[model samples]
Target: MSIFKKIKGTFQLLKTIDLDQLAKLNEKIDLSDAIKNLGELDERQLKGLMKMLTTKAKKGQHQLPPIDGDFYNLDLKLSKEDRDIQLQVRNFMEDEVKPLVNDHWNRAKFPFQIIEKFAKLNIAGIAYEGYGCANKSFLLEGIIAQELARVDVSISTFFGVHSGLAMGSIYLCGSEEQKQEWLPAMQRLEKIGAFGLTEPNVGSAVAGGMETTCKRIDGNWILNGQKKWIGNATFADVIIIWARDEDSNQVKGFLVRKENPGFKAEKMEDKMALRIVQNAIITLTNCSVPESDRLQNANSFKDTAKVLQMTRAGVAWQAVGCARGAYEAALKYTKKREQFGRPIASFQLIQNHLVEMVSNLTAMQTLCFRLSELQDQKLLTDEHASLAKVFCSMRTRDVVGRAREVMGGNGILLEYDVARFVADAEAIYSYEGTKEINSLIVGRAITGYSAFVN
Candidate 1:
């Protein structure tokens, strides 16, 4: 090369290193002397020196591995179209929901503005057939739940209340006429729904101890009771209220409209978790519903279990997402967060926590994958769903706890995002089915004995 060309190339190479790096290099060698010596070198020798310096400059700047929670490559099991849909939902959550999550979650408010964009996704009731549903496999539905919760558990809870519990109730138990009337609108996200099964005094034992009562009066059902912790109830267009019938003494479901004069929903406040979800304490004082609005096929708690069974699987997947989000966030933070003049991720203890988090996350993902498969095959039982819910929720708590531990004090800060996951994991652990309750369900199946009661 010519003298001018060699000097220009040398200057261009120098531009790649910042002043700090250049200063560090100068401490080791005299830069002016090095440049003068470089001019004397032959063309081949100059090229060799440039290559050596370039490699040396890039030595400490190793490329970081991508922040993916799917450690086992489970997504490879999905087809091209399925993978595309997953990416679409993931992008929507990252671009549209994630930016607003911390703020909304802290303020205990919902961002109603995203409804239009969310509606365009057309994912409600995805696993069901007809009634404007996607007729997709249950595996896809679980994956969608995971993707949503991976960003924010509150948003996932909102979607689950509307699509899984509320819509599933109408789909699995409602009459054909009711399905034609409500499913189309709900599937489009034009109408929101809520499920009301737990009450102020009823939770795990709600199956038999449900205090809500429904009476047939004048060809209509009168619902009288309160439902606590009803997600989306404050603004739901319709709520599936499960009550014991005065006549049949069996659990029945009624479609209670929000506009009913006797129907009232009070927003629950001071929540420590899932603040973005508008949980409500609903009161039904003589709330009357037409016979047409009643769930025709829901005659007992056994029928109600159908909806819970399907939704429980989704809850397990939500736990997986919650753990994953924490793991990825912590992983990213560790690599960038410097301590003792080195990245924390390089520390043995920090790496141990990350490995544990990923291991639990991977196990949860594979378990849910099989759980969904059983669901799609129509061979899933209450015990199968319960087992996954129990395992994943418990593991998620451990993962999130370690995530917070690794971050030290920043893990408790909401801005870092790990704190939110820590709190949300608690909710997931207790909500769909508590660790104790779900464990009993599985224990009953294995032992052929019901230990729920004495």
Candidate 2:
């Protein structure tokens, strides 16, 4: 009689549920497990399950909007195809990259596993024409940079080296044969690439302090010196090494292969930030390359500056992504974290922090969008790029700092995500162009005085 009464109750509960309710429950739990164990449940257990399922259904129906950093709805401005690509990359980061990031970051290891899968996205050399590239708008390229950095700045820095510095060097300065040999493979991510411009002794003054010398003899160039902080150098298939011509006293670029006997790359250790990026110190001990491998069109520092002008904009976009990621994570944390029996997000001070973060993030996004537009129109200058890099990196530092502040002690934890952004922002702030260097570049343009050492 008792068993019969419980079965009747189960049947009555079933009548109140429909496929929609069951589908929602599937998202919250493994329904198949529930079904397999249903027969073993006592009357009390059956009643408890019914109540839990009903509560989940109510919560499902009231699902909140997804947390996004785009407070200004900038995504709506993208074309349908562009918007689709953005979402695809976002989903890949959220699903594939996000899960592996903290683990890899904690161990200070690069997740080489993602490279093949990331290649399938087909975004490398996206703005350049030919060479298996999409030849999309520069704006799309900036958007891709933003999307990648939002998840992990190390990943962003890795891609920037391969896609922007390495591939862009060949596209802008490589001979017809050089481009044919390298660009297609590089674009497919079949052959990873690195750029070696910053040497141990020459960071801010790489143009004039270039100690790496290349001497031409027997129609082969011999490279002799070292490069520091070269991203992706440890495992790259090729590296674009910039050196000074011994006789001409002019800066030149070389396509140095990893298989060369004299080329060696040692991984940099104990980095405080961007630990997942494989930065290396490269040594060229009489590294020899065929004359054909030289970047034929790279006659002077002016040509190399062309590549920097373009990639500097990408770095600005990356800063915005870093800020956005921190802002979104902090916002989500505050909303769910409770104090005094209510969410901290409802507190007045927490709201103020959130508001400040979003404002800076939105401003940075709009600035970069316009910078990309100028780049696409061929109206961008070195100063334009420098200004954006300066402003965005500075603003990003503020945004990430506040994000850490709002989270309190948990802000520094690696599991929380915001902590990584806070640390990585420091790297972005200094690289490409430091605040002092980039600001002087902009100031020189506006004031018509050369503040830089010549």
Candidate 3:
């Protein structure tokens, strides 16, 4: 072949070749001086070299579509009205709560100033029928929980304790007159509520082990005992205190108002997690609650479980939110933070971490969707709630850990948002039901064996 023809064929082949690979090939071939000389080439030649480098860089670039944790697009399935409500809550959290969370968490104080803004959402007693509730689907309730926890788990816990645990006690076990007395005002958030179930000695085992006692005397029941870890109890207008009836030996719930004598709720201090929740160590010595205020239908522990069963699903959704918050924060950090003149996200190993984190997050979102569906359908058993709680909470810990891992030192900083999730996830893992407790619940259901307390 002629020399000119041979050179023309070589240039044509090089033009078609992947420039990134060619750049690497050029590097290995010790073309440093030639590459340097090319930099001094004329504008047109320099432009051509720059174009080739850009093409090569683009080829070497990892194509990561925007990471959306909602793999199933469950929001699309919601009705327009429901979707609006969801966005309303989401906006409220993202705008109002997100900015204040780190400060409140660090100070270990509830952002009481936001309560008025929160009341405007009108979501208290959501999904409950009648008595001024929005009567939305249980799905909306789960979505609300997710939105709240996504920004601040402490706020979500406070909401759940009031709306789900306190009001739920009245809704599920209160008589018509009793419900008429409190549900409406509480629904409007004019009167905040708190649930007092966990005593210092009695945790989830309070079903039968409530050391707090109630004795019927004179037209009223006198409650005497200490209730610990009562969220919102410090400022709640009415706290639902569960106690054992001394005579019948059955547990009963009472609507103990804050003004009542002998009822004291001192804020539990120095909490390592969910600090903004305002959990109280309550003491009731001769706290007199009128018979009318007693949750009339709460004859025993079984009645209490009815409330827990409904709220347990919400807790699982909270776990999903906590995981998602951490995951997104970490994913963004990885893309922005650079090492060795490139984004850490450009590293294959970092990407592998992100993929795994998303995998777990997507699994959690999908699982919670079904969980809320089962709840809406009235088919959510203890085992179903337990399964989601176990899986989501456990997986949330993993997700948060990966988030922290990706952030390196910043992961441990409270201002980064991920550290709070990592700390809060620990509390959530134990509360509602510990990993072991929830696992045993599911285990018993599958194996037909009661493994608790034995």
Candidate 4:
């Protein structure tokens, strides 16, 4: 409280500021005169003055909020172990996958080099038991899907086709012998798999109007048809092909090897979205498969529906990731982008766009959370999965559109990252189940009426 102590404290505070800042302050006011007046002030006044000056000096040095997109703190709901796994997968995507995505996507090529590293994650078929899988909850599987698509949608699509559609078919419908034969290797990423269901002439209606046919000859089934838009078909070691039986007219599934004499997969080019995924037009000309390779449990369309129902939930999660990546990218861009000599994030209109994007992103995340919970509880119905696919895919389009809008011209450029998300969202909107088709599935459940045309 002595004059000497006050002067000493003032000097100490002055030392905390740099020379440049002191010069700037001197321009605004007389520094020597201010110090003379400060010596005349009471102890309390001097203390207050010192605090004010120190706070002002550190104004722009305050820490900014983290760049996380999980606005609702949903990760707190996960267990420590589950949370660790989530972080591990997130780190893998951000570290290994992100740097290479734009280049691979622009070139319309898959980075086959990363397959070995990706296999180290050991996440494939995580929800299923045995066969060297992790046997974790379906929620973890959904989270993995979200994390994968958060960095690159094409990689997520490739994973979904292999782990969800291909392995799921064998797990749910394959004979125990067949599962024992393929799943362990597939889980280790030693053998990649693909699903062939959508045909050249049929997509949503393939259940009843399938053109692919199989006949039993000399105890071997002969399959003849073409499957279009088959993800990973070009290099998959195995493909789960669905064909109609000539005798019973019921749909059946066969495990067709890529080395089969009559099987062919040609890469489809000129795609606008998910360019990193190797989608192929598969042709089967009397592809012969032994009876032992047939999926014993997949007897009708209902069996195939089971696989679709499961993967549809995964697709919904993918949409959430796509939207999340775009939102985060745009948010970061806004905070750093300046216009009129100030950050655009400081403007009212930019904040509004950011708020809207996060709102939709949060809603989609919560919805998918509950959807995965239902799957974990074994209560997920086709309608539940379909409704989620419809809602999330629709909302994803809105979130990505706003993301692109906020970035203006830069949003269209691939280097900005939002542009890739914008293009990929269109593919998510149409695939897995179109909005109209999924809505009808939900409508049928609610109204107790089948509106689907035969």
TM-score of candidate 4 against the unseen true structure: 0.87
Clashes of each: 0, 0, 0, 0
TM-scores vs. true structure, each candidate: 0.87, 0.87, 0.85, 0.87
Given candidate 1, what's the lDDT at residue 234?
92
lDDT for 105 (candidate 1)? 96
**In candidate 3, what residue range of length 10 has the lowest lDDT sum?**
1-10
lDDT of candidate 1 over 188-241, digit per residue (tens): 999999999988886756888889999999998899999999999999999999
Compared with the true structure, what per-residue lDDT tens digits does model 3 show for residues 144-238?
A: 99889988899999898889988899999999998898999988888999988887886768875789999999999999999888899889999
From the highest lDDT down, the ranking of the candidates is 1, 4, 2, 3
In model 4, pairs of residues that clash are none
Candidate RMSDs in Å, in order, are 10.7, 9.4, 13.8, 11.4
lDDT for model 4, please.
0.91
- For model 3, the local distance difference test gives 0.86
Q: In model 1, which regions exceed 4 Å deviation?
A: 1-57
Residue 234, model 3, lDDT: 87
Candidate 2 deviant stretches above 4 angstroms: 1-66
lDDT of 4 by residue, 275-360 (tens): 99999999999899999989999999999999999899999999999999999999899989999988898889989999999999
Residue 156, candidate 4: C-alpha displacement in angstroms: 0.6
